[model samples]
Target: MNHPMVVGIDGSAHSSAAADWAAREAALRGVPLHLVHASPPLPGNAVPPPAADRLRHLGEQMLARTVADLGDRHPHLEMRGEQSDDSPATALLAAARTAGLLVVGTRGTGGFDALAVGSVALRMAMAAPCPVVLVPRQPAGAFGDGVPAARDVTQVVVGFDAHHPVSETADFAFSAAEARGAGLRVVMAWALPAESVSPRTPAVTEEDRATWEDQEVAQLSDALRAWREKYPRVTIRPDVVLLHPAEALLNASRGAQLLVVGRRTDPQAVDGRLGFVAHGVLHHARCPVAVVPHVD
Candidate 1:
């Protein structure tokens, strides 16, 4: 049996959009969809028992409504809704333990209007046991139905670090592309050494830059060779950019259906902050971003 895809819900428009995206993906993978709503326990003497009960009821109502709506759209997709008494991050993480992929809104009801991503969403992306997909809200007046515009050319873009390639990350990207029947764009960014610009350093000519670019392209190809063999049907485009990783990824995400990046996880580390590249694209990527956790 295929592991179900889990999505967090909070009665917000953003969460609704996430649920929609998750439903489509779940259907594509021939897996069930699970919707989870977390209602934190009220503090002692913080609110009357009646109000607390009302809050819990509201949470259940939200989940039921979302599940019903999604079921109507995806008639054949199996789905289940649950309400938990733990914090948002805790409940979602627990659900993700047995899930193949976890999905969440980029921002929820807790964040400020100006914040691009919510604290809980960021935390989940960095620490979830399974790969997490952060779905951004549809832009105003862009997709009135909460669905993105269908593109003639579908593509999945992944940021590849040739220096430290992770097979798990590659696997996720290739699988996603294969499932969607979309082309995979493997992007690798490189920059000239800072010392090369020093006054005492010899001037680097155009030929030197060309050679460096060629080397980076070779590295990217070598890293993806095995993946290409494993997923023979996935059409791939290798892109080598002379820019920052975040910028390269954001640019490549213009018409992409999904953007994938890797995050290094340390079991012993207390902090779960995301890496610079993952953080940047999570905030500005035009399409859904998937953060795949791996141990380097």
Candidate 2:
């Protein structure tokens, strides 16, 4: 079965932007688009059947309008929408299982602006079976230039940790870059090793700092070598930052069309986890963010 690109809708500006982005992606990938809205089941049978029917009607109406609007925006693109009776996370996870990619908004109707990533979005980001992209409230980061209408870029930014590299993530980013005919910006953020900071070690000299920086640059190159060979046409930009991983990547994400990060999958665990860097970028980046799952 061919998996379609999926987006979660909640009638919010952010979700609307996400839906629009998903439509563009679906068109780019030449795949169908699926829009899903999850509504919690009403409390016990106390509510009359008509009341329940009205709620369902409202959801269906929203779905219909979204489908119609995007269909008009993307004429040849195949699209469909559905209203499901389940919590948002549950419905999204089910959709992700068969989706080529999943997209969500930074904040939904029920999300708190103070919170970077909402519960549902974060949950799906960490647990979705496929890549999850969190698009911001405003529609930005679409690449390409030229009036009347411009196209999104083939450019993508990805973060890597040299000590704990994940090939799945590297390949995913490369595949996306390759698919888009864009360049890949790879980032690896690091700090002086613990031993370098110990009291036993004298204050690091400029020479030492330079040496460490060189090592970091080498590490990034080595980590991305295979991917470079695999995608010779992808212009690779290697950056090594001496700052927090999250801070470094988030900084690099500026002006990038899409940012990709990795989330470890724990088969024995029920909860999801993301490093500070992934967590930071997901909630704060200006462009759309993609979280890929990896098993250690």
The model with the greatest lDDT is: 1
Tens digits of per-residue lDDT for model 2, 1-296: 15799999989888999999999888888899999998777889977889888888888899899999999999999998988898888999989889989999978888566876688888888788888999987545532332221323456889987777898788878877877888888898888877886677768878989999998888877877777888898888888988888888877776677889999889888767887778878867878899998889
Question: For every model shown, what is its TM-score relative to the native structure?
Answer: 0.93, 0.90
Candidate 1: give the clashing pairs.
none
For residue 103, what is the lDDT in candidate 1? 97
Candidate number achieving the greatest TM-score relative to the actual structure: 1
Report per-prediction Cα RMSD to one decimal.
2.8, 3.9
Query: How many pairs of residues collide in each model?
Result: 0, 3
Model 1: residues with Cα > 4 Å off, grouped in runs: 139-153
Q: lDDT of candidate 1?
A: 0.88
What lDDT score is found at residue 244 in candidate 1? 96
